[model samples]
Structures are given as C-alpha cells and as structure tokens.
Target chain A: MTKKRLTPPLTDADIENLEIGDQVLITGTIYTARDAAHKRLVELLDEGKELPVDLKGQIIYYVGPTPAKPGQVIGSAGPTTSYRMDPYAPKLLAIGLKAMIGKGSRSQEVKDAMKKYKGCYLAAVGGAAALIAKSIKKAEVIAYPELGPEAIRKLEVEDFPAIVVNDCKGGDLYEEGVKKYQK
Target chain B: MREISVEKITRTVRDLCIEAACDLPQDVENLLRQAKEREESQFGRYSLEKIIENVELARQDTVPMCQDTGLAVIFVEIGQDVYIAGGNLVDAINEGVRQGYTDGYLRKSVVEDPVFNRKNTGDNTPAVIHTEIVPGDKLKIMVLPKGAGSENMGALKMLKPADGLKGVKEFVLKTVAEAGGNPCPPIVVGVGIGGTMEKATLLAKKALARKAGEHHPDPKYKELELELLEKINKLGIGPQGFGGRVTALAVHIESYPTHIATLPVAVNLNCHAARHKEAIL
Candidate 1:
C-alpha cells in the first residue's frame, strides 16, 4: 500500500523495486498500444525490422481511448484487460520493454517473462477512464494512425496512478490478494 | 393506433448512446458506494473510491465512464398497433449509433468483420438491435454499450435437465471464478437459465439490462439472485480482484421454459461501469 512516484526511462532498479499492491504515480512519457498494434510491432520484430519508436526502458499503456472533446487533452482513457496482449508481451519484454499499464490478470508466460526480463505489470483502475485521462497531459499518435483507437500514441503523463500487479520478483497481487480475503 | 417516426427513434437512440456512456445510473452508483464501505482490503477500498470518483467525473462532464464505449446493443419493444414511419428500423438505429459516437467523441469499438479482416468500422455502427413486438401502443428503446472486458468473459453451457438447480449454481460460480479479474471485479452478473442455447444467452443479455440491485419479480428467482450474490461476494475477488469482499454488486437472473432434455445457462458479466439508458416513445 506504499505510494511511490515514477518518471519513465525507468532503470532495472526501478522495475526490481516495485512490489505487488504498491501504489505508484507515474509521470513523463509512456507509449500506448492495443492488441492490433501489438501484433504489428511483434510482426515487425519477427522480421528483424526496426520499430517506429524506441521502447527501451519505456512503459506501454494498453488502452483504446475515446476521442477527446473540443477542449480536452484526451477522452475517457482507462486500461484495457492485459491478457489479450500476453502473446506479444514476452517479445516486447525481451526487447527491453520495462513496464506495462493495464487491467486484469496476465498469463503465467507474461509473469515469467517479467521475472526474467526485469519488467513489471501495473494495473490501473479498469473503468476509471476520465480519472486516468486527467493524468495524461499530451497524446499524439506516434505510429499507426490508421488504427483509430488502436493506434500507437506517445503520451506525456503526470502522476498517472497505478498499482504494481506483477513485479520483477514474480509477485502477483491477483493471486495473493484473493488468497488473503477468500472465505 | 399510433405512429412513431424513424427520425425520432434515431434521435432518441443517439442521445441514449451518449447519456448511457457518460452517466453511471443511481442504482449502480449506490452499489459501488456500498462496496466501498464494505471493502476491507486497502487496495480494494482505494479502487472502489477511485471508481466512484470516475463516476462523478463522467456525470458532471461530457465524458465516458470508460474508454471502451463498447458495442452498441439496442433493445426495442414496438407496439403492434404502432406504425413506423420514414425509414428502415435497423438502419435508423445504426445511423443513430454513428451520430452518437461521432458527436459524443465516443470510441468506435466495432469491427467490420470478426475474422479474416479484423478492421474497425470507425463509426461504431451496425448496432446489435433486438426488437420485440408488444401489445401496447408505445415503443421503448434501451441502449447498452457493452465493453469487451466483461463481455469477452461471458459463457453459455447446455446442461442435462437432470443436473437441476444445484448444477446451475455450480456452473455459474465456475464461470465467474474462471473469469477471475478479467471481467473486472465488483461486476454485475446476469444469469439466464433454460430455453435454447441462443435464447439463454439472449436472456442473459436482457437480464443485464435490468436495474442493478433490483430483484426478480418472482420470489423464487429473487431468492436465487440473493443467494448467488452472497456466494459471489464470498469468493473474495473483491474490487479489481486486488481482493476482499464485494466481488459483485448484483446477480440478476431471468429464466424461460426449455426443452425436456436441455437446461441451458448463460452468464453475462458486466463491469462496474455497466452503462445503459432508455426512452419510451
């Protein structure tokens, strides 16, 4: 339950320090990607092609935000479920993806990769879109503009709040948390 | 002996789409509040509190409660004595969805095709419209924007009639447990029992459209709903499965008669955001 602050271009020590259930407020730049974009990124990687953006020591937020209104920075922008991206996560982690911000439990494969690759998985409040969007000061599609919501966007965030779900040490709040409260 | 224009329906549907996405209904809000008060885990309480804050923000501003503004699913009950004027009902509804998503700045989550070409329709169009012919001279339209986080976790199973009520309870619990945090905890579970396979799934969807925390009119069903709610909360999935009590806000069930050999059950999970709005014309 301890609260921490993070500014990305995170280091190995940063990933190793986060534990399950600790609250962290993130600031600085994070990239956004949905499943479709993940597919393309991994496909590019498989073919030994360079990525559109540098992901080393960066966070990728799994979201497909609603379009912003006339005077807004972004629309309702909450985390989507993480499991769908599990197939691509290990590959991204292998390539130095430091952390992921999403909702829901991820597969064991993703968790194992996190442990091995010094990555972490964070969970934002799933349906708290407007609240989450408040932290995002700027967003622009860095890649795949044709993908609409699924488009990869570079975001400048300020105090974006999330909790560590899967840390580098193989801690999973979804498992331990439920076990503690299960009747 | 009454006529309603498709243009009017379109306008109503469009407004409903925006309203449903931005506003968390009172009953649902109350349930979330209750869950927050009851939640023991620090993480669970924090999540519930944050969700409530998000709900208020959505209500006060022109913002959606969730970014996954979801597939536009419409339910219409048209009176037999009513004449529809101007245009095709389905097309009008889709047009409404298109206008609402565009004007409202909601995400267009619909895909043109499920397979082979997984492409977004870009307008959140061709809504899943379910129509029913009723007895009165009025038409009712209900719009629910179903997010895939919970919708993807839905399951339907055809059990042998011999499995009985015990079987139904077990299957429903299994579905929820297997779903884990994927559907988002503090969910609203809609259980549909009996009828054909598709009918059961449809019934489950209809059950979700029912007011959250409202009991079935039938005493037997109401008791079952209560029982299921208690059991689900006991599972300790909590809010967001960060874990503690209050895994679900409600368990609303609808049932219909089925074939002698079949006892089909479907579970439709709705996240805490569960957005729906309606109008009577």
Candidate 2:
C-alpha cells in the first residue's frame, strides 16, 4: 500500500482524496481529547461559550496518555475506543472538525456527518501505544488541565501512522473488510 | 502456621503491577506473532506487527505498553496455615497498588464513585481483589491490569434450562459480532457457563488468566472452546477489528454445576494486550 503523508490543518481536498484502507503518516499539529474533554467542548458549544481550542480544519485524537517519565517527550500514547466519542463527534464535524483519529468503528450518525461535512475518520492501532508515541515529538496540555489525562493536548507529530477508516465519500473500511473476509 | 510479613506482600504486589504493565506475557506475545503470520489482510498483518513492536519497545524502555494502565485486579490464594502479620491484608494490597501506580508512572484510571462524585482516586488504590483459601502454607498472587476498552463490552445472561448449549453458543457469537472493533481485537473471549449469576461473571473474568490458546482440561469443554474459536475467527473482525481471519487468539470456557431450573452464562473479552503476572510465596 502506498502511504500518504498528511500535515494538518487538513483542507477538504485532503480529506476527500482519502479512501477507506489507505495508510497515512500524519505530521504537524493535532489536538487530543477524550470523553470528559469532549463533554466540556460540547457543553461550551451548547451554552454559546468560547471553546478553548479552534476546531476548523483541525484533527482530534481520542486518547488519554500515560504520564511521561523523566526525560521523555510523552508517555505511551495510543488511540482509545472511538464509539464513546460518537455522541459529540457530529457537532464538532458541523463546526469544521476535519478529521478524527482513533480505533474502532464510528456510529452511522458520525459517518453521515463526515460525508455531509467533507470530513474523514482515521484509525490508529490500539494497544500499540509505545510504537505510536515514538512519532510524537512534543506535547503540551492546552485546555482543561483539571481533567488530568483527559485534558486536551496540542501535539507535534512526525509521521504518525493511521488508516483511513471513513472517508468523505462514506466508505467504511470496517464494514467492507469484514464482507471481503467473512465466510 | 507460616508467618509472612505484610511488607513482603505489599512489596510483591507493587512489583507485579509495575512488571505486568510494561511487559507482555510470553504466551500472549507468541500468540500475536502467530497471528501476524496467519493474518490474511494486509492491514491486519501490519497492525499485528506494530503491536508486537510496541511490546518490545515497552519492555526495553521500561514504559507502559498502552496509555490505559488499567484498574489493578489482584487474585490471591492463601493457604490455611499461612498468617499475614503487621497489617490487615486488604490494606496492604491497596498500599501496594498506591505505590505501584505512583512509582511506575501509570495512569490513575479509577474514580472514587461510579455515578455521582466522579473524582479521580489519584493513586489507583483499593484493587479489586479476589481471594481463595487452599491447603498448604503458601500465598499465591496474580496481578491483572485490565483495560476498559474490552471490559466495557462484557455481557451476562440468565438463560432458561431449555436454552441449553445451542443458545449459549449463539449468545457468545452475537456478543463478539456486536462488539466488532470496539473491544480492540483481536480479543480473548472468556465464557463462563453454569453457576449463579455473579459466579458466572467471576469465572468468565478468571478464565482470562489462562495461558493463551490453552483450552479447558475436560474433553467436552475443550471441544466447545475450539468450536467457538472457529466461529469467532470466521466473523472476520480481525486485528483491531479492521477485518481478517484472526479475530481471536483463543476461546476459553469455564463452567460449574448449576441448578436444574437455571442456566447462567457470562462473556468477558480481553484485548490483545492481555497483561498479567504472578508470583507464589
């Protein structure tokens, strides 16, 4: 498979060019958020309050990284299950969230939002945190530090690998791959 | 009576926690290597290779393999003649967990309350301990750091006696199929049959500690395990649920006697990490 190198903030063209099952190596800046942080982000949106970080054309990684030991840029950091973020994803997508990086299948509603908004969803290898963390060059908590590991972090990554699970055209690797292999 | 100091117990528990988080058990690592060789999908094979690489990195660097260091679940078997001195056994175990999470730089995953307060416990103490009393003068301790990705997908069912084996198999298959990629495949499916509701659940969790690809000793249950494993792999959930021929490394079933009128079944899924370690004193 030919690997594509992407540097966010990704444009609509960047996401639309992707297809399910395409391998990608992402660089540049991405933000991290999990369940607690997502709840707060959505709550802020609901109340017409300002969000701590901008979502336009930005990628979000669903992860809660372990605390870094001395002399490390970051600890073992990998994707969490994506379904838990399904409830909040469409709202972010509506507000110009360009892509999501995590493991597992997204809900149909979230996929529909990706198609409607020209966004994409990617899958990082779960349980491969140490290998994944090696791609991250820098990390700093930017919002909701009170949430601890669930806080939003701005990360500078180089060649961070993931697979395109859902594309703007509504292709789903999980469903298609299962159909191809299932007996 | 054999006297063991509480300090010894605490120290052992702390060490086990640190060790288990950073290292993949040999059995699990071997299974993943085999899965990588057997995986049919290109993406699945790649995922397996990365997982294997991650394990090596974690071990070499003395860092956790995954960010979710998990809630500490300790299984202890105490001999009738062994005595724990200097402190209460439970408190000593919690103290060990506190030190392990703090010293190891593991994540503090536990919240003080499930619903209301939702405050981080900070130290990841008060492990979920399961204790059994046995014959000799030895203390056996096993530490399992269970991540929540797969744990959240566990299921239990109280079936009628008429449901029988066919219904049990169907339920197991359905649970895995519905879980799809959510539990972080490839997963280890632990099925507990018979017993009461809670016992069935505990048995399912206990089944996870068995060596990867190991089956039940009984011939009948062993056959059932193999059959279930075959069905699961056929689902094509693959590694990380992206789809392939290796959805699960093994299917383990543990069962006990049940009442004539009742049938209880539980299913627990463990992700590819399946981290655990043991020591006997």
TM-score of each: 0.99, 0.99
Candidate 1 per-residue C-alpha lDDT over A31-70 given as tens digits, one digit per residue, 9 for 90 to 100: 9998999999999999999999889999999999999999
**Runs with alpha carbons beyond 4 Å of true place in candidate 1:** none
What's the CA RMSD for each of the models? Answer: 0.7, 0.8
True contacts kept of each: 0.88, 0.81
Q: How well is candidate 1 docked (DockQ)?
A: 0.91
Clashing pairs in 2: B185-B240
Top model by DockQ, which number?
A: 1
**lDDT accuracy of residue A47 in candidate 1:** 100
Q: What is the number of backbone collisions in each predicted candidate, taken in the order shown?
A: 0, 1
The residue-level lDDT of candidate 2 at B7 comes to 97
